[model samples]
Target: MEKRYRLRKNLEFRKVYNNGKNFWNRNLVLYIRKNDLEETRLGLTITKKVGNAVVRNKIRRRLKEIYRLNLYRVKDGYDLIIIPKKNVVDISYKELESALIHILKISGMLKG
Candidate 1:
């Protein structure tokens, strides 16, 4: 059987582009903007700029995995859009996991 979470439209990916937020020393780039909703949502953007279809899908897969594994560690009431940098393709799952955790920590979603 398949399972799903309460993903809503407020989690829609909105563009912040050059106005995006950055946390140095952290390998992840989060473009966060508040959405007026009670449930948390995720919108992923993997463009051609990242690479070809295969590469883009791979990046998206890794990101989805990271988010799924860490979903319980996050807080509700906001829309979070994460964009992976080019360097992300070169890293392993553990590396990406750590990077995701780091971003959440800085975002004040995770403690310790």
Candidate 2:
């Protein structure tokens, strides 16, 4: 993902958590807030409770790739944060993508 499309600051994440509307499924939680920008940005959160550093990084990379591939299908002008649950480590990549897409669709962030 490009730098402009990634949420990197602590403040950014907090703003989304505090102000954004939330959506979730069995595997992931999604928080979304409008940014008034032309593109959507994303952040991913995977706590140590989920796994060790290697596992966390693997999940992060997978999430990023999923988001990157689906970027075009998502609506613009929103800041999105995705938090994975502990059981996420046990699921396959296709399941992870489906869970993310489920929340996005229900949240009205998925653009056809």
Candidate 3:
């Protein structure tokens, strides 16, 4: 995703973690906090426990692509952090996308 649409700073992630409302599925956890900006930003966290660098990067790439594809469907003005669970390593792209969309709907972040 573009740099402008990504949450890159540690402080930014921490703020969202501390203040955001969260939603999750078996595969992913989403932390969402409203932001003052007109655009939404995204962050992804995949801990070492999830896998090696290659594996974690793969998941990150997939999640970013999914978010990019569905960007138009999401509401703006929020900071979104997605944390993938261990089980996510085995899922296909389609399943991951659906899981994310499910959590987004549950969080009421998806625009109609």
Candidate 4:
């Protein structure tokens, strides 16, 4: 994702977590809140419980790619935080994309 679309600040992530509506599936959890800007922002969280450094980074990259691919379809002006479950490490890219899209759709984050 682009620099402008990435949510990098701790306060921003915390704000989204505290105020946003959340949705979850077997592999992913999504937290979304409205933002004032015209573009959407994305944050990702892959905890240590998921894996070692290499594994965690891999998971993070996969999630970011999934989001990047689907970015155009998602609604604008929202802050989104995605938390992937440990099971995500075992899943294929297609499955990861599917799970992420499914959760986004159900959460009303994806535009029709």
Best model number under TM-score: 3
Model 1: how far is 111 from its true place, Å?
A: 5.9
* Candidate 3 wrongly placed segments (more than 4 Å): none
TM-score (all chains, Cα) for each model: 0.75, 0.97, 0.98, 0.97
Tens-place lDDT per residue, model 2, 1-112, is 7899989999999999999899888999999999989999999988999999999999999999999999999999999999999999999999999998888999999886
Clashing pairs in 4: none
On lDDT, the leading prediction is 3
lDDT of each: 0.66, 0.94, 0.96, 0.93
Cα lDDT tens digits for candidate 3, 58-97 = 9999999999999999999999999999999999999999
Per-residue lDDT of 75 in model 3: 99
Q: What does candidate 1's lDDT look like per residue over 1-112, in tens digits?
A: 0132323343244333334354534456776555466545666666677688999888888878878877777776656677777777788889988888888788776634
Per-residue CA lDDT of model 4 for 1-112, tens digit only, reads 6899999999999999999999999999999999999999999988999999999999999889888888899999999999999899899999999999899989998887
Candidate 2 overall lDDT versus native: 0.94
Clashes of each: 0, 0, 0, 0
- Report the lDDT of model 1 for residue 73: 76
| Residue 51 lDDT (model 4) | 92
* All candidates in order of TM-score, best leading: 3, 4, 2, 1
After superposition, the stretches of candidate 2 with alpha carbons farther than 4 Å from their true spots are: none
